[model samples]
Target: MSTICLYGSASGGIDRRHVELAATVGRLIGERGHDLVYGGGGTSVMGAAEAAARAAGARTTGVMPRALMEVELPPEGLGELVVTDDMRERKAEMDARADAFIVLPGGLGTLEELFEIWVARTIGLHTKPLAVLDLDGHYAGLRTWLEDLVARGFARPLAFEVVHWGADPATALDHLESAPRERISLPSSEILGSFADFPDDRRERP
Candidate 1:
């Protein structure tokens, strides 16, 4: 079974709808005969997803940073828990274990994870598929912003093309499973060309 890495909020302040959404994603993962890996938090969206996945018979693995043990304890009955020295290692562990990724509505930390994975995909670090559950237009703004970035040449169009956007869990998972892994070709000349036009100023900003 493929292991799906989930990224979402760990804060207790998120709306109930988001919690339910996370649970749905989890349930679908298990029902489809897949496994789960996520941040080892027992509260908020992270907890909800893990709980539902475990209940549905999916093997759940919680990868957490040791520093967050006190703040975000893992829930009881997790199939496995992998502790790391820091957040970077935690993310790396999760990335290594999962075959695909899905994102739920979240705050700063979630966005950081999403962007990092997307950047990694662009640079050929991994060819795994990723998606954002955009139920009820929650991620519509972010989608538009990303498109704008692509339009302005700040982001690669292919990078955006690889991300599957879905409004439901089952459909998103299906798309991710079927998503093709394409070889990325980004030469240094194309990437560094923008820097060539910049004025070299050795002065420090006030």
Candidate 2:
């Protein structure tokens, strides 16, 4: 089984469409027998997604920064909860636990998580599906920008293709499970930097 990491807003303003889709994501993850791996925040997208997953009897795990936990408690229930020192630690822990990544409507923090995972995958740190739950063209502008980067030769075309987009949760998962996960060797390529050889869970702060 693979752990699917979802990146989304904890408190950003959300549209009703996004909220409904987020709940469906949790249900799908459970129904498909995939576990939910996400940030541990009870108030926002994280909470909504996990709640849906829990309702469907799917396993869920949370990786949280201790600073955030003092205020935004984790969802009421999760199969696993991990607390870390800082943002870096939180990201690393999520990376350590996830085999794939997904994104939903979110703000800066969500974008940050999405980019870090995108960077990690682009540099061959791990090979897994990175999907964008593209509800109501929520990511249309960013998608166009990324394509522009590739057309301008600022990024590899394949790297720009890292984001798989779909309008609904089922289609996203269909894309996610369509391919076999690829595992990269530590230091497999120099593109990202050292630590490729360190164990999958041992990346150092950059």
Candidate 3:
């Protein structure tokens, strides 16, 4: 019923498994009657997934920064193409529009966006579901690194609690769609605000 933010690489051209997973995410977004909000690039995995969703007749919203759009074309097929000032603004826009988040395989950019969402949840800016689409165990090393961080003193086990990971897009979407919506509290605001103070510290769990 609502939109889910999809975070992933706009590059890499997508391998077979990545493409299949992206397509599956798109199909589920459409079949479940939820809208798709994604990076508005016409190349790589971003295009593949958004195209899949659009082809299936889902209302697709593309959020892009002007810089990325200049580097990569804005997808022409979007139901709503929102051009933002920059990458941070683009993320903020998507954060406002999406009810939940689903991350696919991506590079630094993908990690960056998901980190922002996790921080938002931790600090109480939002309480929406956040999930990772771990296709082909692509995120295995990162997950391990997170565990290692938790073992150390740099992060909280509960901070990592913000994310739900899955290998299957169907189950991922199901969890996202079923997440209980809640109102924000002052305590949550302080938690999210702490991240702005601890930008360097959010990379791992304590």
lDDT by residue (25-132, candidate 2, tens digit) is 988998888888889877667788898887887789889988888666787767889989999998888888887788999988888988888877877778877888
| lDDT of candidate 1 over 1-206, digit per residue (tens) | 79999999999888899999999999989988999999999889999999999999999999988889989889999999999999889889999998999999888999999999989898888889999998788889988998899899888788778888888888899987898877677799877766666666623333
Best by lDDT: 1
- Residues 99-148 of candidate 3 have per-residue lDDT tens digits of 88999999999999988888778667788999998888889999899888
Poorest lDDT segment (10 consecutive residues) of candidate 2: 184-193
CA lDDT of each prediction against the hidden true structure: 0.90, 0.81, 0.82
Per-model root-mean-square deviation over C-alphas: 3.4, 7.9, 6.5
Task: Report the C-alpha displacement of residue 169, candidate 1, in angstroms.
Answer: 0.7
TM-score of each: 0.90, 0.84, 0.85
Best by TM-score: 1
Give every collision pair in model 2: 186-196, 186-197, 187-196, 187-197
How do all the candidates rank in terms of lDDT, highest first?
Answer: 1, 3, 2
Off by over 4 Å in 2: 182-206
